[model samples]
Target: MQIILAATPVVLLIVLLGFLKLPGEKSALITLGATILIAIFGFSLSFGDTALSIGYGVTKAVFPILVIILMAIYSYNVQVKSEKIEIIKQQFSAISKDKSVQVLLLTWGFGGLLEGMAGFGTAVAIPAAILISLGFKPMFSAVVSLIANSVPTAFGAVGIPVIVLAREVEMTDQITLISSHVVWQLAVLMFLVPFLIVTLAEKSVKSILKNILLSVLVGTVTLAVQYYAAVYIGAETPAILGSIASVVVIIVFGKLTANREVKDSYLNFSFNQIFQAWSVYGLILLLVLLTSPLFPFTAFMKANWDIFQTNFNFNVAGTLHTVGIYWLTDTGVLIFVSSLVGGLIQGLSLGSLFSLLGKTTIQLKKTVVTVCCLISLSTLMDFSGMITVLGLALATATGALYPLFAPAIGALGTFLTGSDTSSNILFGKLQATVADKIGADKGWLAAANTTGATGGKIISPQSIAVATTACGQQGNEGVILKKAVGFALLYILIAGIVVYLGS
Candidate 1:
């Protein structure tokens, strides 16, 4: 009875959002209400404690999470308004008349770069749009982009997902350990990504064999850089550096393999134009690095911004709630500054930048509500001990088989929430708890929650919606979902098996 009651919110979420096809925002609100009731009555949590959790959760969703979305979308809008997006598209198209090569570069290389910088669904949406503009069918473009985004996802948005998982598990000291485990677990996916993309795009495994060398080289480069960055550098560096390395290697390979007779004019863009278009992203990277723990001046920044910190703590029903806010040092601030600087470099006036920001905020109104409500629901369940109860049940039932279900739980979190970060936020602690109970490696299991979330990226309704809209096939979400679900399943299965063995 306790297990069933504990799982009621999650089950209802899956039913409403996954099966009934309800809007996420609506479902989130309904689930939030349900969670509050359960927390207050069923779990004996005081109303005050539940309300504090809600406030904490909503605050978190608003600051870095929702603010990141607003900034990323605004940055993209600035590029679009300035027409730099078109130039970037033309430059990619000129690389190869071979539609397959173009698709691989744009979707795998370029898309991976975006994922590293912004994450969420920007990686899929932007690349799918680029592929469509380059003449690929909307559905095909969406499918390939979705698949390509998976390989780089764990480290996406500068490793926020992994960092969040570490914090939630109360194992911040073991972040490097968790990151290493995640990188090793993802090694299989990295090597398979190139081959998988070719198979998905061409609808034939034979094509992967035909282009075996290119596929092998691309995969090798991706895996090598991803491993090095995640292990040696920092969590935020892996996807960015890995994707960049893959693109460079692929381009060099393409140049070498080309028939001697064909000259491609795609490299014709002036260096200045290219620099302007890419400078904003460079700025973001620089800022992230500067503010990152890796930088020498990080201490100075943190000390100077102490005044901006906000802390709240309360006790209700024997539960302790402590939340902290660091406004000045938030990643969102860096992203927003980078967006503005990029817009200026692209020749947008100050007024225009503010106008675009306003529009983006309005557009994301529903997203704001959705994120807040969902986060609140997750927090309430957590504080109410519902999440712990569920995790305990799973740990006991699975026993030695717990590793096999690790990725499944991760995939379920993402499939319901449609965001890897959200999935980690919801289930990372739960995974940690289960691992502790089962005597499994806590870091490995926590990291698995994130690595596994990547598999659900293609099938997420939010991702499908973004892909369809970007490809100018807004109402064709069902078609894209049906086409992508098979790939999603295979990816998750492979992820689960790999994690099971690793554990």
Candidate 2:
């Protein structure tokens, strides 16, 4: 009965958002109220501790996670206001005239690149918009963009998702272990997705059959580079490096298979112009790589940056909860500073850059509210032991078949929260707990949660809304959801099988 009541808030959240279609912010608030009530009365946690836990959760959400979102979106907005985005699109459209090949290059290759660079719906929104403008059907463009967005998401935003997961599990030393497990768990999807993209874009099997070798090449290069990076370089660099490497492979293959009779569309932008436009991302890549653990000065910088750090302790009953904020070493700062320098290099005036920053803040205000509330509620559940109870119940129910249901739980988290990072926050520890109970590999199980969250990207209401709104297909979200939910389930099923067999 206690566990059942513990699940009430989650149930209410799902029903409110999934069934009644309540706005996410409103649903979060309603569910948060329920969680606090349950924590105090049902779980017998002290009201003060529950409140402090909620506060801690909000701080974590704002600092680093929301901070990264603000910088990435601001940088993207800066590019848009400067018209560099148009040039970027013009360059991609120049790649090829064959719609199938273009789909592979733009949606799969370039979309993966964007996912690596920014990845807070930027991957889906930008690529879907470009595909629609390039003459693809609106719904098809949205589906392809969402599917491709899944490939690089675990390492999105310079690998913040895995970073956050590692922090939650309190196993920073095992970052390499967790990353390696996630890479292998996601390996099958990495190979399968390239072919799926081509098949989805082109309806006929004959068209897919013709492009089989090209699809295999894209998949092979992406997976190989991604695996190598995850093993050697750590999480921060893999997505960007892998995506760039795959793009090179695709180009080489395209040239080899080119029909001399057809002239490819020449890029309207000159080499210098292209360089200036993409310099923003190049700068961010450099800064992130320099500050990563692979560098010598990273430890020195982290120790010296204590001035920007925020640390606090709040007692939760007999226990103490500590929240540490490492501002200087945070990825948000790196991306924001890089954005400033990159904007200046691209010639945006200081005044215009600040203007773009202000606009970005305004644009994300609602998102800020939604994320804070949801994360706070999730933390409250965790502190009150509701999440653990639920995980125990799940493990008990599944028994020998627990592995098959693992990815389903992960998919459900993302479907509710619409963020792989948030899904990890809500469920990462739970996965670790269940793994211990079921005698499964703990690191791999924790990674299964994130890998499963990637599949939910397509059907996530937040993602679909971004894709449709960007493509001017607002009311067509239903149609787009119908198209994507199948692939989302397929991805989840495949992920479950991989985890089960590997275990």
Candidate 3:
């Protein structure tokens, strides 16, 4: 009865958010409130402990997502307000404007680039907007962008997941073997992304053939660069290098392909025109690139001041670790710089930027509140031992079926918690613990956790909010989540099989 009651909120949330057509922000809060009240009474969690747990969970879940949300919406508002985004779109138009090419260039190339550079929802948000503007169906555009965003995510933001998973989770008996194997499997998965895109477009063979050549070319370049970086130098540079390499490849090839007919009109790009892409992004590049540890500049920055990271930690499964990293120097700094540059480049006055900031703050109030409440709710669940008990229970129930169900649990954790990093924190230790108890390959279980968590990033309500809002489908997050469920489940199952066999 206790277990059944403890499980009620999560099950209700899944049903409400997934099938009942309940609004996202509303459903999360309602579920959270009910769970907390239940915890206080039915679970016999002392009010103080329950409150503390809620505080901790919110801090853990909200911190990472807060960074993503502010930066993302701010980035979007800046680009849209300043017109730099418009300029970027215009440049794409000077070339081929085929909706499909638009998908390939923006959703596949630019989306991967963002995932490589920024990760989180920014990858989908920015690319989704571009695809919507380019005339793809809105729902289709959001789904395609979400799917494409995954290919580069394994290494995004300098391979955050790979590094953290290696350092924090015991994914294998031979740590090196497990780490490298996980990367390899993800790389193998990358090969199918282009095929997935074509399949999403209804599998037209003739159309597939046209894209097949380009797809292989694009995939090879990205996969080779990513794999080599992961195997050599380090994981910290794969996302940056892979994405930058692919962007250059696609833009060059795309321009050349369209140049024949467009040569006399808008095809010619001067140095000034080339620099145009950097307007909204120039300072962002400086902040993330220079501040990245894999770069020498980050070293220089670290020497000057505390490298601007805010660390937050809490007890998890009776253990503690540094699970939260706020790169105040990286993307946060970029947001400030973007506001300034976006204003200047777009010709907005300083006063206007401030005014816009004020308006944006007000505009995003509900979003901010919603995120804060969700984080607190998730944090409460974690600190109260709710998330751990739930996961361990599932692990025990699945038993020998763990391989098939392992990834789903990880995915489900993040689907509720809203960020993969948090999912890792909440469940990583438990995954390893379970693996040891069962005599299963602990490392394989850990890898399954991270890979599975990645799959959920595309389907999480938090993710849906980010993508839908970015795709201009705000308040319709339920529709988007429903639309992507098929692909997401298939991906999760495939990842499960891969982990099982590899293990």
Tell me the TM-score of model 2.
0.81
The 0-to-1 C-alpha lDDT of every candidate, in the order given, reads: 0.75, 0.75, 0.68
How far is 404's C-alpha from truth in model 2 (Å)?
1.7
Window of ten residues with lowest summed lDDT in model 2: 256-265
Query: What would the per-residue lDDT of candidate 2 be over residues 163-246, giving only the tens digit for each residue?
Result: 888887777788878888888988888778888887776768677665777777877787888888887877776778888987
Q: For this target, which candidate reaches the highest TM-score against the unseen true structure?
A: 3
Query: Which ten residues in a row are the worst by lDDT in model 3?
Result: 170-179
Write one digit per residue (lDDT tens) for candidate 1, span 1-503: 77887889888865666566566567678888988988888998887788888887887666556776566656667778888877777766556555566777878888898788767666876677667666778788888988898878888877888888889999887777787888888888887777777666666555555466667888888878877787777687788888899889777766665554435454577888998887666777677666655555656755786787777765646766666666655666777888899889989899998998898778777667776887677767767888667756765787788887787677766765567887898789878887887788989999889988988776766566556545655445546666777888888888888889988
Arrange candidates by TM-score, highest first: which order? 3, 1, 2
lDDT of 3 by residue, 310-369 (tens): 666655445564544545555645666765775676677888777776775565554554
Candidate 1 TM-score, true structure as reference: 0.83
Off by over 4 Å in 1: 114-146, 157-178, 204-206, 210-214, 230-236, 254-262, 308-328, 412-447, 456-486
Q: Which stretches of model 2 miss by more than 4 angstroms?
A: 98-146, 155-181, 200-206, 210-212, 230-240, 253-264, 312-325, 412-447, 456-484
Which of candidates 2 and 3 is the stronger one according to lDDT?
2
For model 3, which pairs clash? 54-380, 57-379, 58-375, 58-376, 58-379, 171-443, 172-443
